[model samples]
Every structure is written in C-alpha cells, then in structure tokens.
Target: MTGIASHPEIAATLALKRRGITLTLLTTAYFFSYMDRQILAILQELIRKDLLLSDTQLGLLAGFAFAIFYATLGIPVARLADRGNRVNIIAIALALWSLMTAVCGLAQNFAQLLAARIGVGVGEAGSSPPSHSIIADLYPPEKRAGAMGIYSLGVVLGTAFGTMIGGTVAHLYGWRVAMFTVGLPGIALAILVKLFVVEPPRGMSDAQIVAEGQDKGVIPPLGDGFRTMLASGPAFNLVMGVTITSLIGYGHAAFGPSFLQRSVGLSMIDVARYVAPVGAVCGTISAVGGGWLANKVAARYGLHAQAWLVLALKCIGLPLSFLFYASSNPYVAVPLYWVSLLFVSSYLGPSFALIQGLAPLRMRALWAAVTLLVINLVGLGLGPTAIGVISDLLRPAFGEDSLRYAMLTFAAATPWALWHYWRAGVLLKRAGA
Candidate 1:
C-alpha cells in the first residue's frame, strides 16, 4: 500500500473511483457554501424592512461582512491546506460556516447579522483553495476544465436553490425560517465529506514538472504562489480577467432579485418561480457546455483557445445583460436574464481550469488562495457595495428605477474584462500555448 501510494502512476487506475467520489463531495460542499452565502440575497428585501436597514447596509452585510474575512483568512487556511490534511480542513470549515449560517437566522439587528455573516465568510475561506488543489491533483490539464465546469455548477446550482428555496420559505413563513432551511443540511454534508473523501498525493495528476524547477516533495515558501502566478503573463491576465468578471457578476447576482421586485413588480414568489429556475437551467448548460466546448476547442486548436472561448462568452453576456437590465417588461427581461446567465456562467470552467493549470503543483492551493484573495477582496467585496451606492446616488433622479441603472453601470465594465481575456490569449499564443 505504501509503495503504491508513493507511486501515483501505478495507483491511478485504482484511485479513479475515489476521484469521482471526492469531486462529487467537494462540489456538493461548494454548492452549500454558495447557497448559504446567497440566501441573504433572496431574503434581503424582507431583511431590509425588518431591520430598517438601507441598501448600503444590506450591501455591507452581503459584501464586506463576508468577503473580507473569507478572503483574508483564506491565505493562512490555504497555507495550512498545502501542507496539512485537506479533507479535515474542508470538513471543519464546512461545519463552521454551516453553523454560522444557521446563526444568521437568529440575528436581531444589523450588527448581529454582520457578525454572523463574517463568521460565514471565515468558514468559507477555508473551502475553495484546498478544493482547487485537490481537483488539480485528480485531473490532468486536458480534462480539468470539464471537471471544473462540473465543480463550478456548485455556484449555478447553489445560487438557483438559494433564490428558489429562500424565496419560497420566506414567502410562506419568514426570512428567519429561510436561513435555517439552507443552513442545517450542510452540517450533515460536512460529515459525509470527511468520511468519504480521501486525500491524494500532491502532483499525482501531473505527468511532468518543468515549470516548478524544484523537487515535487519540497514545499515552496508562501511567496512562491504569488511569484509563480505573476511569472506567467497569461496567468496574471487570467487572474485579473476573473477578478473583473466576478466583480460585475456578483453585483448583478446579488441585486437581481431586488431589481425584479422593485422595478418589474415581481414578488419573492415570482423571482423564485420565474427567474431563479431560468438561471439554474441556463447556467447549468453554460457551465458544463463551456468546459466541454473549451476542451474541444483546446484539443483542436490549442489550450490557448480557451481564452477566446471565455472572451466570446463574456462578449455575448455583456449585451444580453444590458438589455436585461434596460427593459422594463418582465417577459423581455426574464428571457434576456436566462440568455445572459448562459453565456456569463460559462466563463468559470474555462478560466478556473486555466489558473489551476498555471500554478505549480506543490503550491496550487496557495496560488488559488492568492487569486481568490484578490477576486473576493476587490470583486466580491466591492461589487454589491458599488451597486448599492450607485443605486442610492441614482435614486433621486430615477426613483424606483435606480437598481436597474446601477446594475447597468457595472455591466458596462465587461469590456475591460474582455480586454484582459484577449490579452491573456495573445500572451498564451505568443508562448506557443
């Protein structure tokens, strides 16, 4: 057993089934994390009325309260993951966040909710970096995107369920009940993860290691993750591209329910029934299909082709987003929303798989952590807040129409993100892919 464990190539066939189980459990964990985080979005209108909080306050709860701790704490947590037992870290983190999510339902005021959200962030911070590392070790570069696409479905499915269930529960009972509804099940899921998933040897999936220029057994210093990421021009651009992309994506996603309710006169029930289901279905197709499509493109053209694929997805989504927000008609906006989600959600698999491939094998978790720190701190942390502030500024002029234009304000920045994707592709092509 020890001999086989030491030899990854020899063990690959035997480990294949375990790999599937691990990925499934990890993806399910991600789903719950996102669902817990996103539940507040569906319940925000009710929360606002109950707590007498402003949009800015809600944004703080949604963005700052969560993203700050989630991003900052991730660095140390990821460092631990790189050297420690990733399964234990994931299970412990999942349990912590799940408990905090339930606690969020018990909060009596903005301050209490703020603390609970922070706890949720702290727990979630430990999840992704390690999970990224694990996935990278389980699948090679060619298949990584499709695997990542499957993993990224957590975001799509989580967001869908978050809105659907949160809205339904909040509509029938109250917001507090909705929080508990999504929060408790994660604890049991955490246990399942700890029991079912086994830690694979680092560098198990990679067939070579010229990029690291070091022994695979040597644990590189923490700074190596940052240096390694920046060392590659394409990788740097990919990271920046995702950061920009997520900024706009999180903004629209967080505010979407509010926009429909406030502007289109859709109720919570309407959002759950009419909007959430569309996003789930379209985003699922995009997430899985994007990875599969990028893989086909990469196999035919080169891995660099993925950049172009993601760029196209972003371009398609940008116009759809503008039309979605601009239209006052529910019928028009809802369909546009579905189409926009299809294109926009597809970028995740292609881009994330690229970043994981770019990182050094031993330092993948930290590399992912550093990338996430930037994305969450600047993108997720500010996206919702920016939208809220802009909406507030536009409220006097646009009145109830402020959120629609506020979302559009961020959607215009999609072009800047697309430029990064184009640059990343150009750099990768120059390197001969």
Candidate 2:
C-alpha cells in the first residue's frame, strides 16, 4: 500500500521476477519428471539383454506398471494439493521420483525393477496436478496456454535429452549408469523448489482472490469436482482426444528406439548424436511457438479456434508419422519423425489451457488429475504394452520390422482422436467459449 503511492513499477518488476523464477523452477522439475519417466525408452534394449526380458515385460516396465500407479495416485494427491501447499507437494514429489529413478539402477530382477518404477510413478503422481493448479493461478485464462506451453517445453526437451543422454550413456557406460546419471540432479532441483517457489492463493488468476480469504468458495467434494470436470462437452472430448493421442504417442516413444536400431540400423550413439537433435529442435519450436500462435489465434477468433488448431495439427501429423516409420533412409526418416513430433505435440498447450479454463476454481487440480487418470491409465497403461505384445506376435514373420509395423497399427487409430477434437471444436464454438 505504501509502495503504491511512490514506486509501483518496482513492485510490478519484483512480481514479474517472482513469477518468472517460480515458473522456471516448476518447469525444471517437470523436465526431470519426464526425463526420469521416458529414459526407459532408450535403455530398454540393454535392460532386455541383461535381464533376459521380453519386449512385453519391458513395455510393462515402461508403461503399465508405472502408469497404473501414477494415474491412480494422482487424484488423491491432487485433492490434497487443491487445499495444501502445492509448492511443498511438488518439491517432495521431485525428490521422491529422482531418488526412485536412481534406485532403478539397483534392481537385480524384474520384480525389483517394477517396484522401483512403481515408486517413480507414485512420486510423479504428485507432480503435474499441483503444477497445473499453480500455473492456472499465476497466469489468467487468456495467457494460460502460452504459459502452459512454455511449461510444456519440459516434455519435449526432457524426452529429447532423455534419449540423447541415456542413449549415449547406455552405449558407453551401460543403462544402469545412465539411470543414475539422469536421476541424481533432480534432488538438488527439489531443494531449490522447496526453498524458492511460493504458493499463490487459489483462483488468483481468475480474479477471485479477496483479502478476507481467497474467497473462492468452499473447496468442493471429490464428487463435485468430478461433475464439474465432466459437465463440459469440450472437457470430455479434449481429454479423450489427448488420451487417444497418448495411446499412440507413448507406444511409439516406448519402441521408437528399437525400431530405429533394428529397422534403420542406427546405433544407440547415432540416435543420440543424429536423431535426438532433430526432435529437440523441432519439438522446442512446437512447444513454445504453438502456445504463442494459439494465443494470437484465440485473441482474434476466440477460444474455439484453439480446438481447430489441434485438429489441423493432428490431421497433418498422422500422415507424416506414417512416412517417418515406413521410410528406410535416415535423412528422410529422421526429418519426418521430428516433424511429426512437432505437429502432434503442438496440441498440448491449447488442449491443457482449455481444460484448465473450463475447470472450477476449487477443483482445478482434481480436474487435471482426473484428466491424467484416464489418459495415463488407458493410454500409457496400454499403448506401450500393446505395441510390445503386438511386436512379439509379429516377430515370427517380420523379425526386426515388427516394432515399426506395430507402431503403425497404433497410428492407424489416430483418426479417432481427430474426430474428438473436431467435436470439441464444434462444442466450444457453439457455447461461444
């Protein structure tokens, strides 16, 4: 109050710095989260060789065993975040998963590895929901996509580096050492977050905060949150669209290294050196540019236009993904693969922003958790596992090419996702959202 009479600009500048710093730390935590999760993709082959594990077992380790717990635990943890200190929750989660990821190296058997991965998932369960809630509070509905998009850079960058670093390390030092390499740094990040990130009042971005209290109304029951999230047609369709996309996305992520190695004859180090850079650059563009572009489109055309962007991206990307997997030439395949990633990943910012915009103030974290629940359970839980099993089934006939064809089969069903986005667009437009 005293400052407002004299130097308001200083307060504003300090506020901006705080917001930027918090977002950076949260995004960094997210980077480690996805890195810990996706690192398994590049290491699967080594683990399979050392453990004498089948692709199906590897897929379960990579997907279902982790996803089932992560998705299931996220809801309750999110409910906690909606009321508790979200900064603390996120910090604790980062520490737990980072430690679990390191423990992954110590596993002597399949069951031991599964348990470690399950712990990783459990820790990761507390990650995104609270982060999403915090982001929603920090940025208003209009700018949220761009903010979320910046945050989502963690996903692309993390996935890319997971392969680049993991692949290189696996080639040189082996998979266990790679796990330890990626996992330990997150503990320090957790400390930074715990010390620095501040929890904003709930509904602050929605202009619902008041001095007497946050004044956002009572925190609703779990059932109420479920209803609030489900009542929106856009929410339903958007969640399903993301879920379907994830089914294909996670499937490809789990096996893509294998396909590149066996079908295209790329060495592990080659993928790290040559292939990962393509994804890193293109995916960075998509994550940052997609949100900026969507914000511009939404400003001019309204929120409905965001859905249209997603629709176009998917429709264009699916064909390119087909070409990426089918091609034999590294120059051709790598370029196509990165472009497909750019297109498919561009939807994340717009979709997540829409979902968050639609949520009730008190239930945002729960809503995000529910969205993750279905997406992770059905998509992450099944995608890689199904692809792995399918690859095995086709192994007798196709040998090394089974993983490629298995991924393609998953890709064929992507049109279902496009339809959902189209329907969501129609609904948003009709509602004038």
lDDT of 1: 0.89
Measured with C-alpha atoms, the lDDT of residue 110 in candidate 2 is: 98
Q: Tens digits of per-residue lDDT for model 2 on 236-287?
A: 9999999998888889988888889888888888888889878888988988
For residues 131-248, write the lDDT of model 1, one tens digit per residue. Answer: 9999988898999999999999999999999999999999999999999999999999999998778777777677576345454477788877888788999999999999999999
Q: After superposition, how far is residue 153 of candidate 1 from its true place, in Å?
A: 0.4
**Alpha-carbon runs more than 4 Å astray in model 2:** 1-16, 208-215
Using TM-score as the measure, the top candidate is 1
Candidates' C-alpha lDDT = 0.89, 0.88
The regions of model 1 sitting more than 4 angstroms off are: 1-14, 210-214
Q: Could you tell me which 10 consecutive residues in candidate 1 have the lowest summed lDDT?
A: 207-216
